[model samples]
Target: MIRLSNSVVLQDEELDITAIRAQGAGGQHVNKTSTAIHLRFNIQQSSLPEHYKARLLAATHHLITEDGVIIIKSQSYRSQQMNKDAAISRLVTLIRELTREEKNRKSTKPTRKSVERRLDNKNKHSIVKTLRSKVRRFFE
Candidate 1:
């Protein structure tokens, strides 16, 4: 079982894990051994809560496909077990992130002191710019 939070846990059967050959350079051992792990979890068919499933399905992550399946590939580890663990951990993180609630932002007005300071700075900058203009001498 993979624990997502205090109340959320995912069963092993929910995940479809497979071993595939690792890509890129790793010498001859890489070609002979399947060290990569591919994990697939269907949000619609899983035992997760309705809200969690809904949020997961609505997520726009690259790992989540249009069919409501999350696919994670882990190949950074040298061992298949490590890769599998990494993939599962990544899945847990993704679910947690997608289901987490964000606090609504409250609009706030700037403080009077801050606004005054900003206007002062703007006036200083304007004065400096105006000073840079070519001076006109009536006698010349």
Candidate 2:
């Protein structure tokens, strides 16, 4: 079982994992051994809560397909078991991120002191700029 949070846990049956050949340069061993792991989880068919499923389907992650299937490929590790573990962990992280509640931003007005300070600075800047103008002689 994969634990997402205190209340959410995913069963092993929910994930479809497969072993595939790892890409890139790794000598002859890379061509002979299948060290990569491919994990697929269907959000609609899974036993996850409605909110979790909704959040996952609504997510814009590249791993998630239009049909609500999350596909994760892990090939960084040398061993198949390690790659599988990495894929599962990544899936768990993605679900946790998607389902997590976001805190709403509270709008606040500027403090009186801050506003006063800003006005004071603007006034100082205006005075400095005004002083740079060419002086006129009343006699001329």
Residues 49-81 of candidate 2: C-alpha lDDT, one tens digit per residue: 999999889889999999999999999989899
TM-score of each: 0.83, 0.91
Give candidate 2 misplaced runs (Cα > 4 Å): none
Q: How many backbone collisions does model 1 have? A: 0
The digit string of per-residue lDDT tens for model 1 on 1-140 reads 98898888899999999999998889867778999999999999999999999888887999999999999999998989999989999999899999999999999999999999999999999999999999988895
Point out where model 1 deviates above 4 Å. Answer: 25-32, 136-140
TM-score of 1: 0.83
State each model's CA lDDT, in order: 0.93, 0.94
